[model samples]
Target: MDTSGFLEWLKASLSSSEKTSDRRILRFVHPDDDKRFLRSLRAERPGSKPLRGIRRLGIIRAYSCPVPPEGLPVSFGGAIVWEEDIRVSTHAILAAQRVPADSGIPWGVRRIRAPEAWSRTTGHRVRVGVIDTGVDFDHPDLRHSLERGINLLQRTALPHDDNGHGTHIAGTIAAANRMQGMIGVAPRSAIYPIKAFDYNGTAYVSDIILGIDWCVRNRMDVVNMSFGMSTRSKSLLNAVSNAYRSGVLIVASSGNDGKRGRIDYPAKYPQTVAVGAINRKGEIASFTNRSDSVDIYAPGERVDSCWLRGNRKTMSGTSMATSHVTGAVALLLAHKPGLTPEQVKTVLKRSKRPLRNAKAPRKTGELDIARMLQVADKLM
Candidate 1:
């Protein structure tokens, strides 16, 4: 629901006078101006509005602030890294902390074969709710993954995918993208979208709780939550616990704060599976939150997956990796039908792709679906 007010402001400034351009950018603006700017933009154009009179200058991938900008910057001044525009600055890192662990590099998602799961059960019939930003249901890879999503911004039950993060998470879970071989853990699984995070990836704790309840009432077999906050509320934990009792497999992302050894809540809650990130080297991502609370690690860095507006983006975070586990559980459940949640966790623990076990760094281990299927065979 928020528009690029910074860009809009810049457009206004540029149009106001090619002469007043000498004025300091972002100066004289309050630190909370971004919020006000967005509110104003919303008051003007509600939805699906094209930024008129603004130049379609490529993009600023990341604008690292030399001083962290206090909070969110009030102005768009400073060196920005545009897709086509090159600037100089050693301190300005990308706004995103995502680092590429893998490129377009092909790797197996590790699926159950016909013996354990049916050949026809591509998870197509099952619906998994992804409570994040809305998904681009039309994305070739995510079209099959999407069913219908909610736009909390518009307060509507329609599909709205402004941010590409949700689409990435959805694809990792079940991107049957035209069957382009870009399969998720459960490519056949359908996705019931939920937009908790806004376009800027900002969401509230209550929104998350409400989203979980919605999933529970909808009888979603699995709920993939790839976002987290530092707070630990009994209400949120109770919601997860209740959802678990409702037979919902809750999977959450360990926050990528990179402070080390701290597990973000929701993921740390017993009701959910805490997932970490692994780079293309098959080594743990240094930025991934590490601790015994972490249940499993999966590919998260530089993951090339579905995006909004018919595009593909390679991003990194435990958020994307958690979807792998969610889809894997769906596949195992569809195949084994009788496996309990504990049994599912056991299979994941025992069949890991084996790391240099130095003190069992995490609660479980690295996820290896291939090994999990083998473990399931023995359990049967």
Candidate 2:
């Protein structure tokens, strides 16, 4: 059917139904045609309210709008494409008991040998964007590491932690409290929390795309995505590719499905560095999604980090592993400020410590930050 006929049918269908419809994101084939198309859509239904929450995803040349069901056309003569705003969740699985804080560095931090390379570069001045739940801004351990961040959920509000997931990830990346609390891999690095996810640890695909766009525009050296979705979104992939081309290194979790040869989106995408989880015994975590696409593994089992109300918690997931790698990337960037994502990945790959368990065939080696720096030196 023609575009106008399709729009009329959609409106009639929606008017006949008693249920409310969910919002869908729309992408224009040519970004220049966006206004013309929107004008046409508005012209069809005169005096109707315009689309709300119209977020311009400049990187992907798309718009995330809450268009009413009646206003949404299935296809707009190939000028625009639309997709459901799919949900994405954090990869963290909280342990039953909260672990007491240890004044020294966490085992995961030590395992990666983050401290060994501190004398050379502790990720000084590197900017790492964390796209997840908001952070605990008042947490003492994270005070020095945080910068003013954006809250996509609430534009006027500071990106504060309603859920502890982001704080945990932030602490692992750059918690700088040295005397009474633990130090992270990149203690001097700056963390810019992008609150895309909510207190429920869930966010829509549009929100994540906005977060990635923010990262690219803000010139973040590295971005840590500790969450994943099972299905692929072309919109998300486009944003990732744009960010990668803009010199942003994205580190993402493989997933927690415990399935062999299957990983999650964003990580599964070629532009991102896909990471899986490992335990203290240096074996792959059974819960971690295994696949040949996984670029590396890191200590993820029972990791301790900052939580809400200035507390500490131990959580487990590939999310934790991705944070470790993010911090390590920050360290690399601090030492060699202009290394491309490809170069950074090569250094990590070259310096990885071989896993003891050969049974896990697809798993790559664990992170070795000290060795990574040595490898970087040789490239100079």
Model 2's TM-score against the true structure: 0.91
Model 2 per-residue lDDT at 241? 90
Q: Which candidate is the best by lDDT?
A: 2
What number of clashing residue pairs does each candidate have, in the order they appear? 7, 0
Taking the tens digit of each residue's C-alpha lDDT, what string does model 2 give over 1-380?
24455445445544544646676777766745765555555675554333333566767877676555555543664766788778999998865466566656999999999989999999999999999999999998999999988999999999998989999999999999888887888999999999999999999999999999999999999999999999999999989998888899899999898989899998999899999999999999989998888999999999999999988888999999999999999999999999998889889888889898988663378999989999999985
Off by over 4 Å in 1: 1-121, 178-181, 356-363
- In model 2, which regions exceed 4 Å deviation? 1-19, 35-50, 67-77
lDDT of 1 by residue, 93-210 (tens): 0234322323232252642222234363466566688888788867666665677656654664575777777877787778764424355667777888888777777665555666
Could you tell me how far off, in angstroms, the CA of residue 192 lies in candidate 1 after the best superposition?
Answer: 0.9
Residue pair clashes in candidate 2 = none
TM-score: model 1 vs. ground truth:
0.68
Quantify how close model 2 is to the true structure by its C-alpha RMSD in Å.
3.3
